[model samples]
Target: MRRRAWLHVAVLAALVAAATPFTAGAAASAAGRSSTSASPTLMAPVTRTFTFNGTPQSYTVPAGAVVTITADGAGGATINCTYTGKGGTGGRVVTTLPATSAPTTYTLTVGGSGGKGCTPSHSGGAGGYNGGGRGGPVLVDGTGFDGGGGGGASSVAANGQLLVVAAGGGGSGGVVLGGPPTGNGGDGGPDGTAGTAGGARPNAGVGGGGGGGGSTS
Candidate 1:
């Protein structure tokens, strides 16, 4: 009888030992899963905001000079810009001049018409010498719901002698309830107009076309 009891106790001890490992393994697996789920994901940095006035303005760049401009977008959209340059003998002429080593002064201007029904949150492109004008807003269901056109280019001569001018086109306006639901505004005219405004819908609006940039001797 004593031997039988001892044999039974040994069998129970063995079973308990065998079960302990499985329980420990299950707990470890659960912990690992939890740790993986709790990990955080990294993301890229956000772009900074910029803004510019849609007015006809002028700026001067000395000979062998360079400049950069920035603008902010409205309705969670990005802004765009264009550049042009002209040179002359006296008082900066709008001629087909090339970049030079000496410093010369050239004037820059920016202007654009009113956008149609689209929001007025867009900035006009920069202009020099003879930049083209911007286009009108996009048509929304024939409701004239679009952005305004960019300013036209100037017809000035470089070096006060030869006529060297570059004009950009205006940008198209945005649309709503159109195809694909997430309608966007038309892009700015190439090499002329200012940046176009973004559509007001949930998705991002089309970017405005940049004006043509040039340099004169």
Candidate 2:
């Protein structure tokens, strides 16, 4: 996501537009391993991690099992002297949501990492867990967590409920020539949270990392 010579004002908007909410499941995890059948609660919780590189994953929740999910977004590439691409947003922690119908299997999709832009371009930030895919991190739940990643969304839905969580911040451009008040740094979305702008040569570099969206880490 390097700054192009003729970048339109909407480029940033496009990136923001691509963002979406995340989601997760109800039951917790199993202690040592995944359980087939159980009571109402799991003896130990089960944990899952997604990288968003391969096919989506599938999981089944028995009558009484607890599962914990963790994921990261893909990171952006580094640029030469152009604007920095936005980092992947952070992922969220999700828990207990009523399913459409009491069934077992669940499908999960981890976010993939962002790719580098061409010359004068920079790399995108990485995605976070189940919430923001790290441009490239993760998602889930009406009420989940916010791991550290760039380009994440505010909230997500899973099993029919919304999983509220943190989103990632935007990247900055090479540097500012004149005065724009705000530097080349891209602003954070949903809440107007601002990113640090860049300075002139020698001082010019990529944008600072955006604040985490309720990150657990």
Candidate 3:
């Protein structure tokens, strides 16, 4: 009976030791899983590029798309376009505001032409004459901002033959900022000749002096 009791006690001790290792291993596995699940995740930023009219463009925008427009070459013209998305404005010349947005169509128009010679006496300079300028009707668009007017000729009696002849003056160049059109008309050749009219405002050229009358002894 004593031997049997001792044997039972030894078996119980062996069982306890075996169970302890399983519990410890389970705890260690659970700790490893918990640490793996709690770790932080990292993501990379998104980037994209857009090309328009041979120009390369790029943006680091969020998950979305953007529209773009541009103008090239010379022509009295303005751009027109349509936009869709938040903060959109309809069909109009975009002079100010968001730099990213732009027009699709480039519409150009000729500017008014310079005035012509009415008669030697009434002839105006080449550019921006007859109400000519940036806003003139006959003027070509994008020709230039401010153009000079032609010079006037000396008055003569009807059917009267005059020997003195004068040439009209050339127009002045236009400025960057929309300034006045028309330059001073060249002075008549030598004597008593009328001077050409100057541009509207901002730009004004010196008038041509009248040509001198036929020499008198």
lDDT of each: 0.26, 0.29, 0.21
Query: By descending lDDT, how would the candidates be arranged?
Result: 2, 1, 3
TM-score for each model: 0.26, 0.37, 0.19
Off by over 4 Å in 1: 1-144, 151-158, 161-172, 176-217
Query: Which of candidates 2 and 3 reaches a greater TM-score?
Result: 2
Predicted structure 1, TM vs. truth: 0.26
**What RMSD does each model have against the real structure?**
30.0, 18.6, 35.4
Q: Candidate order by TM-score, highest to lowest? A: 2, 1, 3
Among these predictions, the greatest lDDT belongs to: 2
Error of 2 at 143 (Å): 45
lDDT of 1: 0.26
Which candidate leads in TM-score?
2
- Comparison by lDDT, 2 against 3, better one: 2
lDDT of 1 at 113: 24
lDDT of 2 by residue, 26-83 (tens): 4434234444432232134344433343344555555323333333222322223333
Candidate 3 lDDT, 1-217, residue by residue in tens: 0000000000001001122222235777777743222322222322222111212122221111122211111111110112010100001111111221222221121112233321122222233211121211113233233223322221111113322222222233222223332233222223322223323333232122111111111
Answer with 1 or 2, whichever has the higher lDDT.
2
